[model samples]
Target: MNRVITVRELIEVGGFDETAVLAGETFLEKELLGVTSFDSPDGHKWLRPGEFVLTTGFPFLTHKESSESGLIKLIDDLVEVGTPGLAIKLGRYIESLPPKVITHALNRQMPILSFPMEKAWSDVIVPVVRYINDKQRMELVQTHAIYERFHRHLTSGDPVSNLIPLLHDVLQSPISIHVPTLKWNWETPPAMRKDETIVYVDKQIGQHAPRWMLNQPLARMTNGLFVRWLLHDQKVQGAILLRQPDRDLYAWEKVAIEQSAALLSLEMERQRTVSETYQRFRNDFLQLLVSGKYGSRHMLIRKAEEVGWELAEHYIAVVISVKPHSSPDVETWKENLTLLETIRRILSMCDLPILFGLDQHNRILLLMPATENDESAAKGILTDLMTTLALQWQHPVYLGIGRLHHSWEGIVQSYHEAQISFRSATHAIGLANAPLLHMKDFNELGLERILFADKPGAEAHALAEEYLGKIAQYDKEKNGQLLYTLQIFLQVNGNYVEAANLLFVHKNTIKYRLQLIRDLTGLHPENGQDQLMLRIAMTVHSFGYQA
Candidate 1:
């Protein structure tokens, strides 16, 4: 770090040795960055932050109320411009400053120092400017050294996590690198920020000037915490946060932090590229694995092993079919991409080897290791996985789990079974009426296997129309919800109260709808045979409607 000269330090310099601290003694520690001697009446207007000002006090001599408010106002202006201190030759400026001026300067913490009349302004300005210039030169050298060190780390293939200690060494402060979407962290915090705030930060991302260093903080959190955004392609990909440092960071330290952020951004881009390539290969491998096209099963297993998949004695296949939200505002592709990424991150933490990839149909596919013939354990794992995934998504995302299968061909069967389970459920009941997240397992499918395993042909469609056509026509003509009510009633298994509660209506309404359904289809609501037939017709009708 380059040494900063403070107002107190200026007193020790050769030209400033005879200066007396007249007021604002508490702010003698203010950093002095530049010095200027201006006698113009409007000279205070041109003053900058951290500059030390000097004069014969001649500017105040012409003030109408030079001994009072006019002097106080001048002091206020100097303080507002953030001048480190004002050094005045008091004897030459119409005797002395008013008491109010000193009181105001002291209150504002604007240092007021005095020098003898013989002290030339050049004696002060030349040495201060030289000192500042020398410090800046040293800072440039230090900044370059830090940059080279980071460059060496980047070329040496060190991971971003390893670079944290190097930054800690330079800053002597707690530092963290956070990529929240990726759930990657080098240190403790992921940073506390609202979603909209993050979006705003992203909008402001660009190549900022060096003056932004230390002067502008990306985030204004408390406890001296600040951040530098990690940008990739002009987008904020992540951030590097510095917390509770001994003091504010200097320009060179900020430069080092920025360089580290650049390195991290580069690493993220490289990882993303590598992940994309790996995903393509993984997708292709999964397609081939489930297609049963490979000649040698052992070779296929070896290939899976190479990709870090442990082909257990038994494994269950899971298929997740993403149903796009009904809202036009939702982007289906972006939603699915976020869902898949969330799944990948959560599943990566599992103890058992779980392989994930997209099937040929573009549905998410997972082959999770399981014990031989233990369907319950696999279901438990799938349940936990689905529950975790559900918490991350706002809308319902459906999943189908196949029975555990052993051989390569069995893997294919398991994959198909998984796909069929979810498709069957969707055909039976629409996505809107589904739970927050839907998980259907093949082993759990009973009559649904017979009801939805095959697509209903024209004959099956006709049977459904024969039973439901009258009610459907009634709904279309009258804008009635009898069909919807009947569907809900059947779903609740003739529990009038439950059905009514689901529809937000009275039980009598459900009974009335049931009677109307019976009158239309000539089927009794309480009769088992009639109920079964109605259900089959409804399922078939749903399948046809969706198709």
Candidate 2:
């Protein structure tokens, strides 16, 4: 199963009359792929990793002053570039190797090989090239056989599950394929799991998934072949795993895995399209049911059954939203899909009887049977999900969970609560306290929900103006920043240090402004009541004002 050709094999192919390893004899086992001649100092560029170089020692030997130094530098360059070994055709341009050069090569463990005096550069390069080509030809035949074996199954339009057997055949090992996102049962999509196959993640990459147990079969597992389903922008859709636990992988085996991955990508891409369509239908269906548009209870049950939901008589509704911002439309879509898939996998792995779907509003809707600690369970799910997502998205994505509903039909009310909670969180952006809410914990908004329930009326605006009209007028007249400073100070709970940060000013500047506010408004912020009054006035002014 060894695919790597070694230096000794190539020397045997060259049929050198006499050969000796001057240094690094142990390192002669280095794997070599091809060979080329190096007559100049910069000829290293033509050589690649795992290649042997044939040289006349021209550039090094021609320099009599520092021939040893030149050879030393050449050896360093060869080792740095990953050239396996060097074969010098002796008694040509170079008379003999310097003792220091031999020691240097030994220290570096770089194989310094010598060719018979009769062998020219052509003799070495030709045989090595032919040897590499012969190996490649044999590899091609083996790789072809593997490809054809899988190509037949691919051509037959077999389900992705068929890949397991084909890979088992190619590698002569047991194989398993795990698609983390593939879940649920739907007749139209044959690939969809009938048992709702769960993909578990306590934060592990695809390669790290646990191996299934097979008794007394495997000694060691090989690295998997990951056929990544990537979008045009290089966003991965998912991966198909191929593993053989019985033996170490050869280069040809890896190549075959790559081929199977390609086939799997095409197959999965087609399934993705079909799945997306079905998901859209599911989304529309859930939106209708949750929006309370069902004509009868039977109709609701029927539609729910169509999407494979085993709904309980009583249900609790939850909504998860991704706060939107400026991102490319395509990028946003992909992220949402990826997030939904992950959530689905996690829920399925937990074996929770949850019916979930994505709506057009960038929200995930869920219906679960009401339980004793359903709220606590929901909180735990969001806690782990948000932590995982913060790492997954590499950006701060927020979510809001509505209060549990008494009945499934109460989704409309619960969803609205989630929206309000989400609003309360997002509205606090740029403030000292960020909006990171989950699972009915939107208590952070306390009374602002009522105070700023609607856009400020004329009366509220007039009241705000009366409280700080002098400061506003002064700002307008002199283009001063008293009002701006006041707003930041109030938002930071009258903390001068925090207010200074918002204004990008020193604490002295904030103090001077606070004194000015006291002199101008006659409302001393030093008083806790006055601070509260000022905060209320500011909230009234900014009511329904969005950035």
Candidate 3:
């Protein structure tokens, strides 16, 4: 808080008590920070904002032009420089302010006051400067006290949430804290939840958190909202918002908000450090579970309970990864952690016995309690959750669930199955249009499950070449899609019209391609044996491209 005096207050002082307003009376509330007496023609250029200028109108009197337009131009320069007001001694160098000058000043809302010619400039300068210094000293003392109060809370190890009430009391108004990157928010009464204006602002903050966090503190927004950014390690981590319904916030209130923001930043950093440490330990425990390293069932259960994980008789493994084409930026370790935490936060609402961590491949791994009756509900929850995550991340997400199994050994088997299903999920995306959530279950993989289980070897390569290699080579040489047509034909169960529709070609074109495939591969799409061989070969051949 600067604690500067306003023109309205300045006029109540001893030397200014006899002064009269010549124009722009309504803007007397403009703050006056300093006093200056200058007669240089260009001295206004050097004047700082909030300074009150005292002139005898001599700059205009001795200048080349010394006309009404010249005085009006001087007023314009002063107004442009953001001077609080002008105090001009009258009936000395100039008879009176020109009517045009008064009108211009009035139009610009620049305060113009007439000083009494009898009083010397020293009378106003000396006392006004002393008064400003005294107010500044008071401001420093008050701000220091506010800092001490906030520091006490910080040293006491209080969380960021506990500081909101203190800030609200200081501002004497409703307030909100929003940390969109972490999906965190808090508000005092007259909840921001119901305010559509503030909600829209929050949405904006969510979409542009990385960029908006660096914005200046105390930035004004719609509906009398003042935002002070919470910065940590030079990054904007969150924001503290103050709402003034009936009036603007005072300078001192803003000072308190700033101090509170610093405390919030420190507390949030502390929370993040604690969270990361817990995640590291949890990750180690997950690695142990998936690796089957625990000594016995009883020991595993005890270890799980320590991390708030409830061991269930039956569990299913789920793996989540980002779609390849979803983003161009390399997924850094920090981003992966953010994605993992996001999944945990969303899944915690399901009230199921669930354990979350990163797999050996650095993808999100989940061990969700599975019961025969609740499997469908769990899948539904995952589908909806993945869809929500996709929207939140602004990209498609891949999800894979393994078959449910019993006991510790089953957890390891299900985890391996999940890794296989995770691969299938990525391939499934290429088989159709990309949905926001691409999900696959190991049990539902059908014939592809066998192909995924079989490692690529001499036998697999020979089978692929014996079945569809010629057709693939022909399509490549002729710039054709015969191999693709056969696959689509098998996919639609030999419906020529359906295959043609999926391929976006004429039905006749589909028949022509199938004929070419048969001619080139000596296999037919309508024959059950031939179709099985062709599908298996195509599935195996696709594996050659998987990472």
Best candidate (score: lDDT): 3
Ten residues in sequence with the least summed lDDT for candidate 1: 201-210
TM-score of 3: 0.71
lDDT of 2 by residue, 488-529 (tens): 887787899889988899999999988988887667676775
lDDT of each: 0.71, 0.64, 0.73
lDDT digits (tens) for residues 352-393 of candidate 1:
467787776566788877777677877787778776666555
Give all candidate RMSDs, comma-separated.
11.6, 15.6, 10.7
lDDT (10s digit) by residue, model 3, range 345-383: 556434446788876667778887767535676666666
TM-score per candidate, in order? 0.65, 0.61, 0.71
Off by over 4 Å in 1: 1-32, 48-50, 61-66, 79-84, 91-103, 106-109, 115-118, 153-165, 172-221, 231-244, 292-296, 325-335, 349-352, 373-396, 403-410, 424-547
Residue 283 in candidate 2 has what lDDT? Answer: 90
Considering lDDT, which of the candidate structures 1 and 2 is the better prediction for this target?
Answer: 1
